[model samples]
Target: MHDFIDHNLLARLSALPLESRQAMIGSVAGKHRSPHRGSSVEFAEYRKYVPGDDTRRLDWKAFARSDRFYIKEFEADTNLRAYFVVDSSGSMNFASGETDTKIQYARRIAASLSYLLVKQGDAAGLSVCNDKIHLEIPPSRSASQLQHIFNSLGELEPKGETGLVEALHTVAEKIKQRALVVILSDLFCDPEELGDALQHLRYRKHDIAIFHLLDRQEIDFAFDRPHRFVDLEDNSTLVAEPNLIVDEYHAALNEYLTKVEAKAHDAQADYQRIVTDQDYEAILSDFLTNRLR
Candidate 1:
């Protein structure tokens, strides 16, 4: 599709619900990592067979080898609580087309995810921020929360400098329970600081997924003629020739992007760079499939 968001997108995503990679602290039963193993379909671990243990759960294959009774334990699944943290900084306004701003792309993805999670009978929340967190909604599984999330996303506009590092730390403290924290941003911030922010979340034991939103032109440096490049955040302007700076720009951008990706992996976070022109539905489906694994 030419656009990232479509009315029918949520219907497609409904078949593939969002799940957490780590044990989530949710009140309701759903599909994800759980603290205790039960009758869930996923396999967890094994334990010594006790006198009162169900014979059906006994592993005869292990008994044949060890000559001891061992009970097969399967992982327990629970409903996931997910929070969508979206960047509303000026740089998110970068788009080759009039209607496809980076922030718009991010909002669409966040809304879709929220819909999928809610449809799966899980909790979902929203956080919109730039230099500071503008809005924060606690996770809830209520059916009505979905419309509120979409309305909030529709009303917000990207502005101000990025405060991703600070904003991340702030949100981390707000979420007391373990959850799936999805961040949608252009990530125009200090590399080391962003790493620390991720580390903070990891320290709190939250599973993180980063959707690094970017316009294709930003990576390609494909401005046809020399024009004034204005800094969206600072109101500063730089006059340069694309032919002369393309090589240098690409080199620097590549190095920076590489560092961000490496840092995300180092912190054990799932990072995906989403170009504005790509199909977001396929990207999200792949991500959800991997999470199910």
Candidate 2:
């Protein structure tokens, strides 16, 4: 098992089924609802019978009530194909104290989720994005696919300026079918640009889930003395007295968070803002449980 795959966490979450909020279009019969009508037990809706419709699907009760022919439609069940988009930007290397680096945490989440998806007969894939989309593994249901994804995640490292926004746009254009697109990143890009990229995925009918990873120190700015902060992406340096700029820093952080949240809401993406100090298990558990609702 890879270091990112927590056996205990996997065991605990194994019973919680991963599900999609929207209907998917897949190639095989499975657990999730599909766009096309099929002979599933769950009732969808009824429509007036068409000449070429299956006669067995006709609802005699509906006919008796309205004196007109109607066809009973049931939701078609199909497999889900998911793509875990992980950011390998330089900013993702940050880790305060003993907590895992943002990129490491992302690896854990992506690997764990892909394991669960494949275990339940769904297809899972990976996209490692940094200055560009460095690698892309197409979704696959084969058991060996999990190992392949794990290997890719294990070798990934964070470097260079973030190109997450452009990478997302490319993903939106590349994926031809509806899929669950899970994103794990610090999301250090312009909120407006991020919003546009998210909207592109939404417009393509892909279900979006975002995990905005941040470190506690980055959020708290607890440094009491003057410190030199280096830009991980561009190698720029800033020497500032925390006392002098704490207020402005906080204000800017708050404004950024507000805009990001609003954009995510507007796109209807499932977004989770996480501090690195928190347990990833708890984070994932909450995410899985909420989708069950």
| Candidate topping lDDT | 2
Candidate 2 at residue 54, lDDT?
89
User: How does each model score on lDDT?
Assistant: 0.86, 0.94
| TM-score per candidate, chains pooled | 0.92, 0.97
lDDT of 1 by residue, 100-144 (tens): 788888877888888788888888999889889999888888888
Segments in model 2 whose C-alpha atoms lie over 4 Å from true places: none
Candidate 2, RMSD to the unseen true structure = 1.1
lDDT of candidate 1 at residue 67, scale 0 to 100:
100
- Write one digit per residue (lDDT tens) for candidate 2, span 214-245: 99999999998999999898889999999999
